[model samples]
Target chain A: MRKVAVIGAGMTLFRRRLLETGKEMCFQAVQMALEEAGLELKDVDAVVSGSAPDAFDGVHMKGEYLLDGAGGVRKPYMRVFTGGGTACFSPIAGWWHVASGLADVVLVVNEEKMSSITPHPQYAFANIWDPILDRPLKPNLVWIFAMEMNRYMTVYGIEKADIARVAVKNKRNAVDHPAAQLADPNITVDDVLNSEVMAWPVQRLDISPPSDGASALVLASEDVARQVSETPVWISGVGWCIDSTMWTNRDLSFPEYLARAAQQAYGMAKIENPRKEVDVVEPYDPFDYKELHHLEGLLLADKGEAPILTREGVTQRDGELPTCPSGGLMGVGNPIAATMGIKTGEIYWQLAGKAGRRQVPGSPQVGVCQAWGDLMQFSSVMVMRA
Target chain B: MVGEEYRRWEGDMEALYVYTAGVAGDRFFREIRDNERLMGTYCPECDVTYLPPRLYCETCFSELNEWEEIPNKGRVDAITVAYVDDKGERLARPKVLAMVRFLGANGGLIHVVDLPEEDVYRGMEVEVVYLPRGLRKGSFLDILHFKAI
Candidate 1:
């Protein structure tokens, strides 16, 4: 297998309602990525695309529908989806394309158009349930997150304020992101606490907004990458793993799926101590507590130590190890696929010394991007170095 | 994994659906059943067309232009076989779900197959199977399945 490097990254504005269709959203992102890498559609050898659910875009066979927009028309294009974790796994698929020597340059793209659904985007989540067991309960998507948040709070004795602090940090970070849609800093723990209770332990503000957007990354072999850009971010390790869909049967206090994936990634990257080896961390944060949940999974902090690290500002931009410096999903908009792109993209920019104002205080040598999705069914981890 | 099966009591009954509004959807499935054809929208600004239809073009950030008929004869993109139902029960039988690249179309659809499961292959040619007249509905299942030519 050859070494793979990310040469470029691009995305569309994360919005609540975009006039564009899913495929077009894909094109916008893919085109930008290619242009950034000084490549063209013809240069891509394969395409990899992903989306959370066809339910969100109101289209089945979504990957096929998104083919041409992703520049896969007649190429070897395949879509990979792991519900929400798809945002991260999609890029891993691209990494493999170049790594396997089957494709010299791979185009990775993902999109979620939640606006097409009426009333509430939550209605589309009615599909994630088990038709025979859980669906009968008519549960909304928020219920699952709420239950998990409650479990975390109970197990770690973490207060809602500590979790709310993530929302504060990410949203503030989004203020510097160009495509951010929810970059509101006026948010307070009281505001989050006072927000409408969609479910127990989860208020409206503790969650990411239902958004429509797309993101893309251009990945190439080390040879192609060196020719495209002077500073290419090398993919040191890539790992994706899945747990059973029986989310209700397990303890929701920690993401075991994430732990397993991180183990594989860290093992591949040859990192004995992740806290010291990884300078930046981008753990998924679809919900506020999730950031903390994944922090533990990433071993940035011990199982129950995320709350304390977060409370002490240790996870801030200038802290010991900056996490979600790009404002994360909570602040940037939860477009599912785009969040993962931002995580990986931030590492690219940071490595290239081009993150502008959001850059960490130093030239971080290594960074990690992790995401969780499905009914806690999947987790994907990737570690990159400059 | 196959041959082994289990049937435990499932608590309640629930159904999943993907809903869409505006004329794009209404016409999307409508044309498939009415004309036994597949269609997509073209974005004049981006110079790319779409399948599964859309009300707006995401690239140029403009509303989609008129619909264009795409051939229903393309290569098989990917496929998977299912031996279980939504209840996680192994079907007494197995079924094939395929993603076919319709002719002259940018995207394809996922549907059941009329061919024997063992005979199917990726990159094989296939065409849409329209509902016989009088059975038409403005839903995705309208086409029923795509069959080998």
Candidate 2:
């Protein structure tokens, strides 16, 4: 396959309620990315739009509704949704558009308007469960995730404080993010521990707020990229995997789906030791413990040892393996599919040396970003290089 | 076990949504409700006027910063007579629905046309009959219907 490179990236402010519609947000993000790449809509050959669910935006056939704003008018446009995994999966779809030589330039847009859902966006998750087996239980995401967190803690003998440290580090790192919604520089572990408990062991502070936002990335063939950008970050590898829907039957402590996804990406990227070779990482962290859990799943740390890395400050922005330097979903806010801004977007910025204040200490060449979604069943991984 | 009868369970998806009109829609609807005027966004590059006032041009994908006041008069591009309500119940009077396209605009608005079935024809000019100012809300409902001009 031919090589693809990310030439531009854009993101809107992560907020609880944005006055702009999903189409408007997509337009703003696509405009920024086009401006950054010094390209026009006519230059785009195809478009890949991503959003978590139709319920969140309150619009059916959301991809078609959002296509015009994403500059997909009269173009090859397709929508991909894999729960929250669409953040990175959409970019992967853009990669194939370029790699397969069907398109020279592709724009990938991910948008979410979670605020449109009344009461709370979490209410949308109720429909995601199986009608016969899962829906009857009236289980919400926080309740299910609480059980997952409790399992991980019980299996590893981990402290809540250790998991809270990820929140502290990411929120602190978000202080430098211009579009972050929850940046708290002086936040402490005690603040998280003392926060209101939504579910046992899962406090309100540990969760990222549902947000309204859109993110865009411009992917181009190597030739077009080299012609347009002097510092194009090549998408060296991409991988995604999803496990069965029966989440109750599996081990919640470790994400086997993420591990398999990471292996596929690593195998293509040809990096044997992720801990040493990967310069920066952006693991999905809608919940604080998911960050550590993803780290182990990515094989960046040994099983149950991810919390140790956090305790020693290994995942800090300036640490040995800086993770979520864009403050991740925890600090920057979680807009579901729109989190492509911090996941793959942050990785591209870091590898291109354009992360500004949120930049890691050393010059990083390779970065790996992962997004988890579905009923703890989906993971999408992308490996990028400067 | 293979010959056992299957039982089915019933459930309802209790999902509710509150959609905002967004930036352009807010401005467009506000103009209609407050000033009784229709607004359209113009793209100089594409030389296209977008009805419903989109923030950007769909063709050229350029930001449409230019706003123009469109006359609340248009010609019916398409018409359909609906005999049933949304729930498929029969209605006493058929609703005249038409896609009204404004002159010099790239898109049109689809709404009910308050005209007799015999009078409603494609290309027939129609003018918007808005609700009274006191009853106007910043929404499409503010325009009661289009009447034959």
Candidate achieving the largest TM-score: 2
Instruction: Mark the 10 consecutive residues where model 2 chain B has the least summed lDDT.
Output: B11-20
Candidate 2: tens digits of C-alpha lDDT, residues A1-386: 99999999999999999999999999999999999899999999999999998988888899999999888989999999998899899999999999999999999999999999988876788888888888777777788899999999999999999999999998999999999999998999999999998999999999999999999999999999999998899998899999988888998989988999999999999998888999999999999999999999999999999999999988888789998999999999999999999999999999999999998978899999899898889999999999
The candidate 2 chain A region of ten consecutive residues with least summed lDDT is: A133-142
Candidate 1 per-residue lDDT, tens place, A76-176, comes to: 98988888888889889888888889999998988888887777776777767787787777778788888888998998898888888888888888898
Model 1, span B1-149: residue lDDT tens? 36668766555323343344335766787787678777898887777777877655543335576789988676678888999999999998798989887655556688888877888999888888788868977678778788888
Interface RMSD of 1: 6.3
| Residue clash pairs of candidate 1 | A20-B57, A20-B58, A21-B58, B73-B103, B74-B101, B74-B102, B74-B103
TM-score of 2: 0.98
Q: What are the lDDT scores of the predictions, listed in order?
A: 0.82, 0.93
Model 2 in CAPRI terms: which quality? medium
Candidate 1: list runs displaced more than 4 Å. Answer: B1-149
